[model samples]
Target: MGAGGDAEEGVELEAVREDEPMTDLDMSRACVESCVRFREGTLKSSHVFASVSCPILHKLEEALFCFTANTTEDASILSSKNATPVVLPFLVRFVDFDNKVFLEFHQIMTDRKFRTGKQLCTEGKLEEGLKLMKEAVDINPTKAEFRGHRAYWLQENGQFDEAKKEALTVLIKLNPSYLMAYQVYYNSCLLTGDVRGMQDAILRMKSCPGRVTKSRCKIEENEQILMILKEFCVRLTDLEKTKNFYEILKICKEALKIAPYSNEILVKKGIALFGLKRFAESVEAFKEIPSYSTSFRLLDIMSKAEYLSLKFPPAMEYNRQAIDLLNEAAPERKNLIKFRESMAAISEEIKEVLIAMQNKDWKSMQERAANTKNLINSGSYKNERLKLQMMNFEAGAFVQQKKLDEAFVLVNEVLSAWDTNYEALSILVDINITVGKYHDALTDLERLKGMKKGVDDQMVDRRILEAKTKQQEMKHATEPPTRFLNLYTMLKLPVGATDSEIRSQYRNLSRTYHPDKTRHLSEAEQNDANNRLLKIQTAYGILSDPGRRNNYDKGLAALESRNKTDSKNGLVIRLEENRKKYPKVFGLASSSEEGIPSGSSATPTTAPSPESTVTSKKRVQQEDGVISPDKVKRFKAN
Candidate 1:
């Protein structure tokens, strides 16, 4: 053997020598020397003296070397492999073994590995940290510290069953007094849905000595868990209060991952689905809870889902179940009376809606629907589907009353709120057609056809075709008339009438068709008379002005020239000749009076002579009270 091997073998032999009893200090010094020699590569495992001193000393030397080096990787390997399995017992039997030194060395090695694993965990390398922690527990199976660490890592990694096992081992087998172990156990119980286990852990923690005077790792962990639980509870309560169902559903789903079998979480999920009007989904969520675990709130939600799905019988059955649960509930339960009243009101409203539907009494349906909506707004009811159904019924009542404009407005609101609603769409289509909004009707019909499930396509197509046909007919009927109406035709006058004659004609027509003259007529007739009277007044106003009359005459002359090929042109010529023959009647001024305005009267210089007067009387008598045309001509000649 080499000098180094000789020296290591002699030390092992000296440790086994029974004649010289070593004190605790002597043993500690020897262990420290062995660790230094092992690091210097002088202590070889192959140079074995005996199993008793060699195995224990060899492991202790290696553990102490790793601890003194403070190499996390080497320490982890030593602890994980349980390199000191026999070291404790060997020390206990040794003459100079120091328990304090043994504990210190083990602690140093364990701490190095633990800190490394914890670093890995802090860095979000949970799987690697879990592996390291598991190795730590394997190395020191009797240390609650190592087991508690492993349990925490397991719980964090979502290995609740494994974490619970590790925590139980620490609390039950390794060290029953470890407060951190109880904390880990409680957390595991919470994650694994073991309520009783969590309560037991909490009690043990509270009963722990120095819990208040001394700060403990477990207390910090417990507070962290409490803060998390409180935050979740507050968030859920706020979501429920605000009726934010979608967000509530998401939050509940996350909560379920933490406590998969939690009845409270499942009930909250069911209620959120119900709020979203996902009745079937809500029912499925509710079904996850066992009957024995079901509460009045859960039962009520289930009943509401069935009710909204139009399964009235099942709804009623669920409501009965809820009532039974309520009756069996403790009398001191908060909100018990309020809950019972709400349930009864729901049952009553359901009956009313069903009856109204059965009788097809739209008015009654509307009233019931309105009441249900009010109940929902008042927070007595919480069914969005029911509220939508009530709105549909109210819209239908408007349709039944033939208040189509009102119906249109109401149905539009319903469709805006729930675009996929078939009844609302159908009602909207009907309203559109009734009010001559064919384009809108067609648009709604197309949308309805595209729906996954909706009104009959054939019926809708028929309505579309009818709407198209009516639209075309309306276009044709509303086209402007082909005949042209001139000013003369509008006033019912001859083409060459004088200004005075036009005025006279307008007065007669206006009186005949005046608004007051048609006051006793129907509205339509009164409107028509007013329109005609307005036209007559407008035409008279245009022709009464000289400037406008000249412009109108020019337009009329142009029109006459354009129509010269027709017989109407000959009638126009004859009317012009009659104007020339009766110049005075047509308001034509003579050449001598050209400077005088037409409306001014020409006063006679002297009164009619006595002979002229007697002659006019004789002429009127001779002509049977009518003046002769030759006598009026002779008087003008004289």
Candidate 2:
């Protein structure tokens, strides 16, 4: 007979034998057919499936075969009575002609068991879940879905290697396109530091051509992609924390390819680049983020990159924006305070540099620049722009000190690295002008003008004019006469003055032009006096010692002959002019009929006669008691 005639005959026989209870075999067969009919939507409005109030049916109706069947107690009873084996044949008979039905049955059973295991896991019964999941996998050894669940439980319980093996079995041996299996495999690779394996799994899942026909599996494909990207982001964060910037950047790029518009991933990529000292690239990465995204972290990183790149104005603007966004963002963000403090410190450093530049404090500027460079080198600061600014500042200081070669080297280094650096270019132009390299200065100024977006073009134009004027004036002039002053001219003395004479003049001039003596004068007058006092001290120091004086006389003679200039004539003119300008300082009288002192015939200065010196000594002895050696000896003997 056909299967339909056999079913009808069986039903008729059951009705005829109503007085006798149905055998376990009969009940199992009936229950299996009922489940199949119900799944097919042909059977309806029946509470009892096989002469028993089955809770599994109720659970299936409520959870739609997605959750665990809360019938473990009944299942245990059935298993203990050896009823599963009797039921197994009926299950096979109902699904024998339809592989779809068999697949659905296995899927439902696997999902139920996996849900039960997950519940146990949530209830602090991890070991119980592990054992139950293992049993589920053993029952359906060929089902990739069940093995994927088992792999997850294994990973949760710290059996990473075993989890990886199980996941690989599911993906490679059973179902190559299983999305859940790929997730498990990816996570296992991540935890074990197998980055290559993780990457391979990501590529495999991405390239999956939808082998699994289930709608749920198709939905899981997108979900698995998201999960993998999130996992990579987490790993990137961990790597960044350990300062593994290169690895972080690599992972960030990999994740970016999956979700190109993901703001979180882009932010992380920019941060990694910033950590790697790739400031320009880092800024470009951050710029990929959409304008509407309210991410303080993104703004902060962009500001830092700009600052390091030496774009101070923009860096400050970005910093303000970041701070404002942080205030408007979630108040519970843990890094808010720390980020603010860091920004504040950077702002302070920039302010100090700006102030020094404005005041033209070359020495202070140089010192601060050194300190900023140290901070950058030590990784305390990550602003490349700040480092460039510091280099420019030091070069400016060198220019002020007339260290042209050193200044040129540093300025060129900055310009080569960042051609658009306005400050560095400006300083380079100034150095060129100072060294009479007018053509070079004009070239730099032209470059600067071309790149001057927000800067004062008028100021640059004026500088250009000044450079042209100086260049023209140089053609007519005799190479700009160098002002070389000898020690005698500096101290207002003749070149051949003796040591005692130089010392006497130095004492008088120092007291007269001292800063303390000029305190009552105007600020300009006081500054002039201070400068003069410094020059006088330097000249006196050079001409005070006999050895130094001898060397100075020789150098002075050589310099005078080289230039064909008589500085002694200039010294005499300065002495006469000073005698009129400050009469009390240079009004010492001279005797013309007296002879010059011994050992100073080169100076040609006349003094009072020898009788005048004896009379002055006798007067000093009468005023202050003078004791002879004979008188002292007689008194001691007494």
Candidate 3:
């Protein structure tokens, strides 16, 4: 062989000698080194790990680690920049023949990758580290660290279920010896609203302060959850979803024990009492926060309470006050989402009531009564509601009080504003019949019948009877020849007649009347004849005297007016004229006429004070800028 060939064979023989000494530890180390190199390449791709040095620096680092690992100080300083690199020296320290070296090498390789993943995690590069950790878990199933990292990533993304499963798997696989995954599992439980899990986690946290303390809780998070639960309970209470009042009250009482200062609880109590028909107690409960919570609802309920008290003027007064207060309390004009609906409903009811009274509107009244059925059953407006619902009560009251126009005005509002209200129809019925509007009465009655459902048929029949009675009364006032009314009769009989002719005619008529005229005939006949003769004589006198005739004609023209309809306007006019024409005759010729009205009772005829006859619309002068009933009181002073 040549010299060059001999040199090459000598190197090949030395390499074979080196391979002959390779042990099982050396083979395991080779496997670990291969894995570590792959991890380093991944770390370099991940930005989690620093770049590998230039070839010169890399060879220098390897030599330094090999030479200094025996001294702990050099090794510790070397680990400051990169903790994972320390695993290399720990592995290198074991002899090549030692079987423990391979296990140590695997640990160091796993730990280095893990340490790099943690640094990346702190910098918010979670997905990259999570990918590596998942792969590591597959490779090393018993390592809880890999599973813990995956669970943490899921928790960050709000994937609590997956995170919880992973954490549980890590705990199970680690045999409960390693407690690292306990906190992450607890956090997942909390996010899922598992209180029992939270308690267990909290206890574990307390056991190891350092571990548990790292699991941070946002401030007041617990209280916030409690607050949400409280509101949910309150809404349920308001809905009355419980079986009944007692059940709802119990629910409220239980909630109150948890939050005693709850305003919602107090309002709920008031509502419960109202539902139970305890008006006085309900009012007391509602009054608890009149100013605290300004709303039309409180006023509406309060008004209902007062109306149920059965005292009339107070009921009206309270209702008026409630309407006014609601107006003021509303957030906007016409924004009465609830109360306006109520007013609109009640407006129709009032109209039906008045119509029932007028035309004897039975069906309308019954319908109105039905509309108020719930209110009555609950005892909302007991007496006032009952009174308004009576047969023709409101209409009769209006007529008696000489407030016909006001009554009509109110009924008109009910018809035009309220929606197809039977209550309004009933009211109009009673009013029309009472006011002698037979045609109006008839129309409303028919309309009421057409709309009738569950009607009181007896009430309808009664209305028809009352309507006939009203028709008769109106006929008596207008019928041409039923009885002799002074001028009305005299004019009907003859154009002209002198006083003597009238008196002579009267005497002859009296004898012809017989017992009927002078209690010598049937009572009906006597009433009929006496009425005829007296009217004839009065009419003759009115036509005979020129002044009386002229005055009578004027009153006859005014018969369609209010005063002329009830009283004899001609008679009042003559009385007025007589007093003016002959004051002395009317006053009895007083000698000292002091404080006497011209035709008044025989008192003095002079002024008590000149201001007494000031004749202004307002009699009292402005006294200290106050205007009141005191003004009338001043005038009525002795």
Instruction: Put down candidate 2 lDDT per residue, 343-413, tens digits, no spaces.
Output: 45555564565567668887777777777666665543444445666687778787777665566667666
In the order shown, the candidates' Cα RMSDs to the true structure are 29.9, 28.3, 27.0
By TM-score, who's the top model here? 1
Arranged by TM-score with the best first, the candidates are: 1, 2, 3
TM-score of 1: 0.38
lDDT per residue (tens digit) for residues 358-394 in model 3: 5665455545545544444344223333333332234
Q: Could you tell me the lDDT of residue 487 within candidate 1?
A: 75
lDDT of each: 0.60, 0.60, 0.49
Better of 1 and 2 by TM-score: 1
lDDT of 3 at 224: 55
Q: What digit string (tens of lDDT, one per residue) describes model 1 on residues 1-638?
A: 33345445544433446777665445544654553344356764333222224334445646554444544443346656455643332222232333444445555555656666878988899987777666666666787777887788877877777887888887667766676667667777776556566657766676655554225535556555655655666899987776777778888888777777666778788887766556778889988876523566676667666755645455556766666665545652334345446645754674675577668887787788778777755644454545665676677776786655455556555554455566677777776555444555666677667453333588878988987876565444334334555778789888788988998898899889977788899999998888888778888888888899898889878766655534334333443553454233224222222121121122121234423433332111111111123322332332
Residue 154 in candidate 1, Cα distance off native in Å: 20
